[model samples]
Target: MTEPERRLWQIVRAGRLGFKFQRQVVLAPYIADFAARSERLVIEIDGETHGSDSAYDARRTADLEARGYRVLRFTNADVMTNPEGVARTILMALGRDPESPLSPTLSP
Candidate 1:
Protein backbone atom coordinates (compact mmCIF):
# COMPACT_ATOMS: atom_id res chain seq x y z
CA MET A 1 0.00 0.00 0.00
CA THR A 2 1.07 3.56 -0.61
CA GLU A 3 1.56 6.02 2.21
CA PRO A 4 -1.83 7.58 1.57
CA GLU A 5 -3.48 4.19 1.57
CA ARG A 6 -1.85 3.33 4.86
CA ARG A 7 -2.99 6.56 6.40
CA LEU A 8 -6.59 6.18 5.25
CA TRP A 9 -6.64 2.59 6.41
CA GLN A 10 -5.88 3.74 9.93
CA ILE A 11 -9.11 5.70 9.86
CA VAL A 12 -11.40 3.07 8.36
CA ARG A 13 -10.06 -0.20 9.65
CA ALA A 14 -11.51 -2.37 12.41
CA GLY A 15 -15.11 -1.32 11.76
CA ARG A 16 -14.17 2.29 12.36
CA LEU A 17 -16.77 3.38 9.85
CA GLY A 18 -19.22 0.92 11.38
CA PHE A 19 -18.32 -1.50 8.60
CA LYS A 20 -15.40 -3.85 8.43
CA PHE A 21 -12.98 -2.72 5.75
CA GLN A 22 -10.52 -5.01 4.11
CA ARG A 23 -7.33 -3.73 2.58
CA GLN A 24 -6.18 -4.71 -0.92
CA VAL A 25 -9.41 -6.55 -1.59
CA VAL A 26 -9.48 -8.67 -4.70
CA LEU A 27 -12.57 -7.98 -6.75
CA ALA A 28 -11.49 -10.35 -9.54
CA PRO A 29 -9.41 -8.55 -12.17
CA TYR A 30 -8.57 -5.52 -10.06
CA ILE A 31 -7.69 -5.14 -6.42
CA ALA A 32 -9.47 -2.45 -4.45
CA ASP A 33 -7.66 -0.23 -1.96
CA PHE A 34 -10.30 -0.81 0.68
CA ALA A 35 -13.61 -2.56 0.54
CA ALA A 36 -16.58 -3.12 2.81
CA ARG A 37 -17.96 -6.24 1.25
CA SER A 38 -21.36 -6.24 2.95
CA GLU A 39 -21.97 -2.67 1.90
CA ARG A 40 -20.56 -3.21 -1.61
CA LEU A 41 -18.57 -0.05 -1.19
CA VAL A 42 -15.02 0.27 -2.54
CA ILE A 43 -12.65 3.02 -1.52
CA GLU A 44 -9.68 3.73 -3.79
CA ILE A 45 -6.72 5.87 -2.81
CA ASP A 46 -5.06 7.29 -5.89
CA GLY A 47 -1.43 8.27 -5.77
CA GLU A 48 0.87 10.00 -8.25
CA THR A 49 0.86 6.89 -10.36
CA HIS A 50 -2.80 7.24 -11.22
CA GLY A 51 -2.18 10.37 -13.23
CA SER A 52 -1.61 8.08 -16.21
CA ASP A 53 -4.30 5.59 -15.32
CA SER A 54 -7.31 7.82 -15.74
CA ALA A 55 -8.83 5.82 -18.58
CA TYR A 56 -8.10 2.53 -16.91
CA ASP A 57 -9.50 3.86 -13.68
CA ALA A 58 -12.70 4.85 -15.45
CA ARG A 59 -13.11 1.39 -16.88
CA ARG A 60 -12.43 -0.17 -13.54
CA THR A 61 -14.97 2.07 -11.87
CA ALA A 62 -17.52 1.28 -14.54
CA ASP A 63 -17.00 -2.42 -14.14
CA LEU A 64 -17.39 -2.18 -10.39
CA GLU A 65 -20.54 -0.12 -10.79
CA ALA A 66 -21.97 -2.68 -13.16
CA ARG A 67 -21.42 -5.24 -10.46
CA GLY A 68 -23.46 -3.10 -8.00
CA TYR A 69 -20.56 -1.61 -6.08
CA ARG A 70 -20.23 2.05 -5.20
CA VAL A 71 -16.67 3.32 -5.64
CA LEU A 72 -15.21 6.34 -3.87
CA ARG A 73 -11.82 7.73 -4.88
CA PHE A 74 -9.49 10.13 -3.13
CA THR A 75 -6.18 11.58 -4.20
CA ASN A 76 -3.01 11.27 -2.16
CA ALA A 77 -3.12 14.94 -1.31
CA ASP A 78 -6.66 14.65 -0.07
CA VAL A 79 -5.65 11.96 2.36
CA MET A 80 -2.41 13.57 3.46
CA THR A 81 -3.81 17.08 3.82
CA ASN A 82 -7.47 16.64 4.68
CA PRO A 83 -8.05 13.19 6.05
CA GLU A 84 -11.01 14.31 8.11
CA GLY A 85 -12.84 15.55 5.03
CA VAL A 86 -12.10 12.29 3.29
CA ALA A 87 -13.41 10.34 6.25
CA ARG A 88 -16.54 12.44 6.41
CA THR A 89 -17.19 11.97 2.72
CA ILE A 90 -16.68 8.25 3.04
CA LEU A 91 -19.00 8.14 6.07
CA MET A 92 -21.64 9.97 4.10
CA ALA A 93 -21.25 7.56 1.23
CA LEU A 94 -21.93 4.73 3.66
CA GLY A 95 -25.41 6.26 4.05
CA ARG A 96 -25.46 6.31 7.83
CA ASP A 97 -23.63 9.49 8.66
CA PRO A 98 -25.28 12.04 10.89
CA GLU A 99 -26.03 15.47 9.48
CA SER A 100 -23.96 17.17 12.14
CA PRO A 101 -20.86 16.26 14.14
CA LEU A 102 -22.55 17.26 17.40
CA SER A 103 -23.42 14.72 20.00
CA PRO A 104 -26.09 12.16 19.21
CA THR A 105 -29.68 13.12 19.80
CA LEU A 106 -31.04 12.32 23.23
CA SER A 107 -34.29 10.50 23.94
CA PRO A 108 -37.07 12.60 25.38
Candidate 2:
Protein backbone atom coordinates (compact mmCIF):
# COMPACT_ATOMS: atom_id res chain seq x y z
CA MET A 1 0.00 0.00 0.00
CA THR A 2 1.15 3.58 -0.55
CA GLU A 3 1.54 6.08 2.27
CA PRO A 4 -1.96 7.47 1.86
CA GLU A 5 -3.44 3.98 1.61
CA ARG A 6 -1.63 2.98 4.76
CA ARG A 7 -2.93 6.05 6.58
CA LEU A 8 -6.51 5.37 5.52
CA TRP A 9 -6.14 1.75 6.59
CA GLN A 10 -5.10 2.90 10.02
CA ILE A 11 -8.18 5.04 10.30
CA VAL A 12 -10.44 2.18 9.22
CA ARG A 13 -8.77 -0.24 11.60
CA ALA A 14 -9.38 2.09 14.52
CA GLY A 15 -13.12 1.15 14.45
CA ARG A 16 -14.25 4.55 15.72
CA LEU A 17 -17.08 6.70 14.38
CA GLY A 18 -19.23 3.61 13.69
CA PHE A 19 -16.58 2.04 11.50
CA LYS A 20 -17.03 -1.17 13.46
CA PHE A 21 -20.64 -1.10 12.40
CA GLN A 22 -19.57 -2.81 9.19
CA ARG A 23 -16.76 -5.08 8.11
CA GLN A 24 -14.02 -3.15 6.28
CA VAL A 25 -12.30 -5.10 3.54
CA VAL A 26 -9.41 -4.52 1.13
CA LEU A 27 -9.84 -6.01 -2.33
CA ALA A 28 -6.59 -6.98 -4.01
CA PRO A 29 -5.41 -7.40 -7.60
CA TYR A 30 -8.23 -5.08 -8.66
CA ILE A 31 -8.79 -2.48 -5.92
CA ALA A 32 -6.32 -1.06 -3.39
CA ASP A 33 -8.32 1.08 -1.01
CA PHE A 34 -11.07 0.02 1.43
CA ALA A 35 -14.49 -1.62 1.23
CA ALA A 36 -17.23 -2.42 3.74
CA ARG A 37 -19.05 -5.62 3.04
CA SER A 38 -22.23 -4.93 5.00
CA GLU A 39 -22.86 -1.64 3.29
CA ARG A 40 -21.47 -2.71 -0.06
CA LEU A 41 -19.35 0.44 -0.13
CA VAL A 42 -16.02 0.74 -1.90
CA ILE A 43 -13.78 3.69 -1.12
CA GLU A 44 -11.18 4.69 -3.64
CA ILE A 45 -8.30 7.05 -2.94
CA ASP A 46 -7.40 8.87 -6.10
CA GLY A 47 -3.89 10.10 -6.83
CA GLU A 48 -2.09 11.58 -9.82
CA THR A 49 -2.77 8.46 -11.84
CA HIS A 50 -6.51 9.17 -11.81
CA GLY A 51 -6.12 12.43 -13.73
CA SER A 52 -4.64 10.66 -16.75
CA ASP A 53 -7.38 8.06 -17.22
CA SER A 54 -10.88 8.98 -16.17
CA ALA A 55 -12.49 6.60 -18.64
CA TYR A 56 -10.84 3.63 -16.96
CA ASP A 57 -12.03 4.77 -13.59
CA ALA A 58 -15.56 5.15 -14.90
CA ARG A 59 -15.45 1.62 -16.24
CA ARG A 60 -14.19 0.27 -12.93
CA THR A 61 -16.91 2.11 -11.09
CA ALA A 62 -19.50 0.72 -13.45
CA ASP A 63 -18.22 -2.80 -13.04
CA LEU A 64 -18.26 -2.55 -9.25
CA GLU A 65 -21.73 -1.07 -9.28
CA ALA A 66 -22.90 -3.92 -11.46
CA ARG A 67 -21.70 -6.26 -8.74
CA GLY A 68 -23.94 -4.51 -6.18
CA TYR A 69 -21.27 -2.28 -4.70
CA ARG A 70 -21.78 1.42 -4.19
CA VAL A 71 -18.52 3.11 -5.09
CA LEU A 72 -17.52 6.23 -3.18
CA ARG A 73 -14.52 8.09 -4.52
CA PHE A 74 -12.20 10.44 -2.67
CA THR A 75 -9.04 12.11 -3.78
CA ASN A 76 -5.77 11.41 -1.95
CA ALA A 77 -5.86 15.02 -0.75
CA ASP A 78 -9.33 14.55 0.71
CA VAL A 79 -8.36 11.42 2.61
CA MET A 80 -5.07 12.82 3.88
CA THR A 81 -6.45 16.21 4.87
CA ASN A 82 -9.82 15.33 6.41
CA PRO A 83 -10.20 11.63 7.08
CA GLU A 84 -12.69 12.21 9.88
CA GLY A 85 -15.03 14.02 7.57
CA VAL A 86 -14.56 11.22 5.08
CA ALA A 87 -15.39 8.76 7.81
CA ARG A 88 -18.49 10.75 8.56
CA THR A 89 -19.45 10.64 4.94
CA ILE A 90 -19.02 6.90 4.92
CA LEU A 91 -21.16 6.60 8.02
CA MET A 92 -23.83 8.71 6.47
CA ALA A 93 -23.77 6.47 3.46
CA LEU A 94 -24.07 3.41 5.63
CA GLY A 95 -26.83 4.84 7.79
CA ARG A 96 -29.48 4.57 5.15
CA ASP A 97 -31.92 1.80 6.08
CA PRO A 98 -33.52 0.74 2.84
CA GLU A 99 -36.61 -0.56 4.60
CA SER A 100 -37.22 2.71 6.40
CA PRO A 101 -35.61 5.94 5.27
CA LEU A 102 -36.31 6.76 1.64
CA SER A 103 -33.88 9.64 1.26
CA PRO A 104 -30.84 9.43 3.49
CA THR A 105 -27.96 11.83 3.16
CA LEU A 106 -25.61 9.53 1.26
CA SER A 107 -27.69 6.86 -0.43
CA PRO A 108 -25.06 6.04 -2.98
| Residue-wise C-alpha lDDT for candidate 2, range 1-108, written one tens digit per residue | 777776666666545434443323545336536777666778888997899889988888888888888988888888788776676666668773323434323211
lDDT of 1 by residue, 7-89 (tens): 89888887766788999999999999999999999999888999999999999999999999999999999999988778888
Best by the TM-score measure: 1
Q: In model 2, what is the error at residue 72, expressed in angstroms?
A: 0.9
TM-score per candidate: 0.89, 0.72
Best by lDDT: 1
lDDT of 2 at 90: 69
lDDT of each model, Cα atoms only? 0.85, 0.67
The list of candidate 1 runs beyond 4 A from truth reads 98-108
RMSD to native for every prediction? 5.0, 6.4
